[model samples]
Target chain A: MNPKIAAYLRDHAPATPCLVLDVDRVEQNYRRLMAAMPLARVYYAVKANPAAPILDRLTALGSSFDAASWEEIEACLAAGARPADISFGNTVKKVSAIKAAHAAGVTMYAFDSEPELKKLAQHAPGARVYCRILVENKGAEWPLSRKFGCEMGMAKALMVKAAEWGLDPYGISFHVGSQQTQTGAYQAAIARVAMLFTDLRQAGVNLRMVNLGGGYPVRYRAEVPEIDAFGDAIMGAMAEHFGNALPEMVIEPGRFMVGDAGVVSSEVVLVSRKGEDDPVRWVYLDIGRFGGLAETEGEAIRYAFRTPHDGGAEGPVTIAGPTCDSTDTLYEKSNYRLPLALDCGDRVELIATGAYVTTYASQAFNGFKPLAEHYI
Target chain B: MNPKIAAYLRDHAPATPCLVLDVDRVEQNYRRLMAAMPLARVYYAVKANPAAPILDRLTALGSSFDAASWEEIEACLAAGARPADISFGNTVKKVSAIKAAHAAGVTMYAFDSEPELKKLAQHAPGARVYCRILVENKGAEWPLSRKFGCEMGMAKALMVKAAEWGLDPYGISFHVGSQQTQTGAYQAAIARVAMLFTDLRQAGVNLRMVNLGGGYPVRYRAEVPEIDAFGDAIMGAMAEHFGNALPEMVIEPGRFMVGDAGVVSSEVVLVSRKGEDDPVRWVYLDIGRFGGLAETEGEAIRYAFRTPHDGGAEGPVTIAGPTCDSTDTLYEKSNYRLPLALDCGDRVELIATGAYVTTYASQAFNGFKPLAEHYI
Candidate 1:
């Protein structure tokens, strides 16, 4: 854990099962990302962690915004972001949202399908648009379902349609996947996107931008490549493909920006075994999957743990949240082992959980309150 | 669709992505459950859907509630339920929640481990307690994680210790799993619970009740056995085991009580294919997994979708929710087929969503509001 967050947790000892975030860490992460990729403009994905304090800090850092909905765009606007600096990045947009974002003066948009493109054309007339292309997600722990983007063939037509509909065919975008560990993934996606760009250019559509959507990894239980590595891979790929005529580069990073900036402080509600012979201890925490740890679904995001007895004797354990539903069981087969000294009422911290925790919370599922957030 | 809900949706024309529930259907379902399981007391599991209107109606129908947390207990109280009529049924509970529920005069607690039992002894002294035993969930569509219950031997010891610790060792409980299709599943669980009862009686603990935890299936895309079948199997097993001296029977039904009583009214945001030659069309809806169709996770609950052109020619489809995250995609491999004529901005209804829909909604995930709910 970062020293600033550690100090706050020790001094304040806020309620259990709450997220305590260091807004300073968010700025540091933002700076590190920018320093690593100096050429690409940072359009902070607001869907990652749209906390007012975090947004305010990033806004002050001159960061552009990639909003998934009008509500997020409003959040960015409230955080002092300029409308032109905000991109309506979600491809699946409602007409009302399109009208609202256009009227609010947000200039950039994204679409993958013709219907969505038409909705954008009819509602947000003459908005700058980008087409997301489906790319392989071979090495990402949380691979996207290929639900957001379209094939290259469709992309070619969509760019032409966008221009014919009087919209600016601004750029092309693709997500490698979240918690992407392999730098090669980005290289491969950029290569595919480059082919589409060249094809579109030959057809007389001068697409002027490339959006490298978020997939940068944050340290969890496993060590990941440094942000500099991703920067080098992306830059090398751009140089290899587009040479001296590179398009205006944009990177919309969600998890990479805030995933490691916060910690979830929870208390052990109970610790027991199924039987005397059972090897696994069931560690029930006050927070569970419904309590905003939805990333733990399928045990895909293995969050590291911090306990007072970390170096003490340990045993195999199955960690679960406090909700009654079994689906709320966070890690049963992930081989999580906690300290033998761990018992009921022990305070523990789920490390590196800032990005996708708070908003995924159920609206009081199993009667637990939505996760509380503390921005320090 | 229920005529009342259909009429409400037709007449009111509420915004897209809303749940229109038939509260009158809730009364009918409750009555049906009572008629089928005449010997068992009904404890409506509040975690399934704690909508105030449903609770108010169920409370008026004299239903006991199985609350997973203090908030749910409080919700029951607000619905005018007697504290004694509610069960604090979650095996994993926080110390604060235990204290609060006890202070609120709620009785009848559940515990699967010693630490939780000890907490009960200290906080809700002399409370009626039950031990949930691990049972096979072979035939349930939504099998539990085996996170809730302990081994039979452990449950036996826990019940004996309950009396030693000055609490009433009330009964033994087992859940067959949600959306259970086999009546034999309940029969097998009852036989197991009956053995526990007999063993505890011999051990001088004399546990009285048998809590058949909720697993009653609601019809979705397939047919399930009638509630009468489950009731018959349960009663038959009790008679076969205990003869004429059957203990107090109790049931906690979360899904079965209200699963099919509601429909989700949504609009088609977009419709497109991955490529021209691709066989599957992607149908994007206004709501998805984060928007409270969470039961659709892993395609466990196959909700039958109704489109404006449902009876027309159908084609293979991959259904997804309108969000930037690909994880928000609801169904991909479920082999769902939609009408060929379905297009953007078309009204669609997801049937059998009355339970486990509203509360599972992510709090403005991707800036989309938590699902709007209407109980007519």
Candidate 2:
């Protein structure tokens, strides 16, 4: 655990199983991203840690927002962000939400199908619309399945349809995947976008922007490249592909901007052995899959855990959350190792968990309150 | 969809992506269980669906409750249930929750660990306690992982410890698993509990009760045997193992009692082809994994879906939920076949979803409201 975070926990004595976000770290992360990619516009994805304080801090730092629903647009507006600075980034949106977003003065939106384009034209006529092109997201830690984007043929047709339907064919957008680590994935996606841009221009549709959707990674259990490395690779790829005709570039980062800035402190509920000869012990914590850490779905994303009892001899342990549901077990297959002395009531800090924890917490499962969030 | 539920939706026109619970069906399910297992007391597991109306109806029907937390106990109380009719059934519970349950006059509780017994001694002394013995949970649809119970030796030790700590060693409890279809699994678990009962009696810890934990299956996609088959198997096993020495028998049933009594009505959000050559068409619903259908975790539990346009010849489809997350796809791997005429704005009803859908819904993800529930 970071000494600063430990001290903050000690000083405030906030409720256990609560999320603590370090505002200073968030600012530093924001500044680092801005400094690394000077030419690209930053739109912090609001679905990640949409706590008012995080949004206020980012809004004060002049960060734009990538909102998926009208509630997110309202949240951004309440945090003092201009509607022009918010883009409705979800390709699949409710028609009423589209009208609400348009009426709220939000103009930028994303779509991937002809039906969605028709909905956009019906609700948000003359809105700046971007068609997302599907890209191969093979190397991402959390590869987005074919849930969001469209093929090149469909994308070209959607852009043309948007123009005919009286909506501005603003640009193109693509998400490599969440927690994306490989820079080559971005390069490959950009290359695909460049080819599509040429094809769209030849078909008489002028694009003005390119949304490199959020997938930048954070250092959790695995080592990931720094922001500067990704910035350099993206800049080089854009230059190599589009040369001097690079459109206004924008990046939507959810995990990278706030992942390292927050830590979740949970109390150990129980420490027991399943059998006498069992090699690994089971450690149950107050927070779980439903509490906040839903990203541990299939154990694809592993968060770094710490106990104050660290530095003792390490032993293999299976960690679980405090829920009656069987699927609440967190690291039964991941081979998580914790200090031998860790027991019930010991505090375990899950570091780099700021991004996707809070908003995903179930309201009340088994009557347990959702994981509370405490801002530092 | 049940014709009654379809008519209910057509007449009421409740919001889309909402759960419609059939109260009359719930009562029928309760009566059917009562008729099947006359010797066993039924405790409706409150975690399944703790809706106030359901609880009130069940309470009026003189149904006992299996509460997992203090809030559930309170919910039962508010629904007019006596404290003596509630059992604190979760093995892992907060110390404060134990105190609260004890203070609220709940006497029967379940525990499987030494630390939990010590907490019970501290806060709920002299309370009736049961030790949940670990059992083979294979062959069930949703197997209870090693999160709940202890081995035979540990169970014996725990009962001795509970007696020593001034708590009544009341019973032994074991859950076969949720959606447990095999009646033999219940017989096996009962036989193990009978052996433990003999051992505990030899150790001078005479137990008075036995809890056959919740696992009874409900018909969704697969056909489940009638409740009478399970009752006959359980009674035969008890007669064979403990012959006329059956203690005060109690059974907790979550899914079996209420699962088939509810239908979730959701509007089709989008129907688009990823590629024209792709065989499987994508059907997106207004609700998703976070919205309440989280039991689709691994596509292990497949709920039967009905479209009003159901008879137009079936075609393969990949069903997805309306969330920005890629993991929200519900039935890509489950081989869901829907009517070819199903399109956007059409209604789809997920049957047998009354048990675990609403309470597990995340509050707000991607700005979409959690699945709403309406009791009919």
Candidate 3:
């Protein structure tokens, strides 16, 4: 544990687990991503961590937003972001949400099917629209291409249908599956989205923009793809596919924008054994799978643990949240070494959890109090 | 779908994927369990749902509660359950929580370690306590036999230590595990706990209460163990082990009492296909993994889905929740028959989800709001 970080926690923070936002870290991440993708309009995926302070900082730094819901869209609007600069990127949306977006004067929303277009026409007629295209890869861990996007062949038909219904179809949108580690997958998606745009233009569908929805991988663990190279490769592929004469570029970067900017701190309740065959120690903390770490899929984002008084490395110990459910183990087995003699009431901090932590991940189980957020 | 259930939803219910509690069903479940277990005192585990109406019904039925936190204790107390009838059972509790429980005049709590006992001592000195004994389980799905219990001999020592600290050391408590399928496991736990009682008595530690912590499996599907057989086997085992000489028995049953008493109604927003190669049908609903079914544990508990119109035994379909995450699938591939052609705006009911079905299961993800509870 860093002595200074530990000392700061002891002196200032409460015993409750909290989501901490560091402006310096967020600014650094934003600047670094912008430096890599200088040409593409960087839209911060507000759903990742939509805290007002973080959104305000990103807006001041000239980052646009990708909002999936009206609440998020309103959050961005309240944070001083222009509606035209934001994209209602979730392909599946409610009629009320679309109507609200239209009333709020937001122009673009991603749509997948003929039915969605009809709903959009009823709710937000003649609204600026982007057709979300489904593209699949057999080898991807999670193929978002599976069911989200519209087919390339059907894109023209959908656009025609949109026109017939008096709705203005803008362009195309595609989301490469999240936590994408393969750069080639993103390059392929860019090319596919670009091809769809060219096809639509050929079909006389006068497109204005192309949105590559957010799936930028935040390096939760060791094997995550580097953001800079992936961004550069995607841009190069887009240039090659659309001959650099393509419509305006938009990329939704959720985890990439704010995942590493936040930390969660909680006090240890007990250091007990999780099971018997393993005399392994458990550090039970105040947070669980509910508070922003809802990776119940077992593909949980890895977290770094630190204590306020760690003077030495402790043996392998599993960290658990206070929820009585046995499935609530945070660290199944210790990946990091920690100080020995760690007792109950010790405070620990989980690092780089800012993306989907706290308010976004709360369930009122075990009568657990929701975590409060703090900005630094 | 039952016509009455469907009509009730169409007129009285707000939408599909909303939680509905049948007060009659819950009361029947409570009465059946209490009647089945004549030898043991039923302590409804408030952590399961703890909805005020459910708590009130349980309290009215003369049931005590096993509260895991101060909020649960407060919930029980607010519902007219006397503090003396509730046990704050989380061994490792927050100091403030312990104080709150004490202030409510909750006299007894569970303790597993000396450090936790020390903290509880500080908060509620001279509090009545039950030393948690970890029963050895060689093979059990719930290996909480791993994280919580005191080793047989260690429990004897902890009891002695508690007595020395001016704490009233009551009988023993052992949690077999939650959602336990194997009825024999309870018998094994009972025998072990009974032997521990004998050993403790030999060591001059006599206590009047013995808590076989509740792990009564709630049948979410048809394949789960029969509750009657499970209860009969456990009671028979108890009779064989201690006969009428057994200490006052306390059992904590959470899901078993309420799992089948509730239904979540949701509206299908859109039904779309992925691509040519992808054959999965995505039936998007307003309810997601985070709303009212968060305890499904990455699709751990599969609820029966039925369209209110007509669900015939016809074919298999993939059901996706409204959350934007690719992993937000409620049922990856569900086999069910529908009598009608299901389309957008159709309501679907997910059944056997009373436990952990309401406020405890919802996070504000995907803009899907939690349904308000109204007991009928």
* Candidate achieving the largest lDDT: 1
Cα displacement (angstroms), candidate 3, residue B361, comes to 3.3
Residue pairs that clash (backbone atoms under 3 angstroms), model 2: none
Off by over 4 Å in 3: A1-11, A134-147, A150-160, A163-165, A198-208, A219-226, A274-279, A296-299, B1-10, B15-17, B133-145, B223-226, B276-279, B311-313, B333-340
**Where does candidate 1 stray beyond 4 Å?**
none
lDDT of 1 at A196: 88
- The predicted structure with the larger lDDT, 2 or 3, is 2
TM-score of model number 2: 0.97
Judging by DockQ, tell me the better candidate of 1 and 3: 1
Estimated TM-score for each candidate: 0.99, 0.97, 0.91
Tens digits of per-residue lDDT for model 2 on A1-376?
Answer: 5566778988987888898888778888889988888889999998987889989999999999999788899999999999999999988887888888989899999988887888999999999999887888877888898988888888988888899999999999999999998889999999999988999999999898989998999999989999998999999999999999989899999999889888999998888776656778888899999988999988989999988888899899888888889899888888789998997778889999999888788888888888878777
Q: Best TM-score goes to which candidate?
A: 1
**Which structure is stronger by TM-score: 1 or 2?**
1
Measured against the native two-chain assembly using Cα atoms, what DockQ does each of the candidate structures obtain, in the order listed?
Answer: 0.85, 0.72, 0.46
Q: Please write out the lDDT profile of model 3 over residues B173-205, one tens digit for every residue.
A: 888777677788788888887887788778887
lDDT of 3 by residue, A1-376 (tens): 3243444566887557787667667788888877777777888887777788888998898888888788889889999999888888788887778889999988887888777888888898888777887765433443453557767877778887787788887788887776666778778877787777767778777777777766666655456667887778878887788785767878888777777777778888787652334456767788887655765236446666667656775677776678777666777643745677777777778776777665455567888877878777
| Cα RMSD (angstroms) for every candidate in the order listed | 1.1, 1.6, 3.3
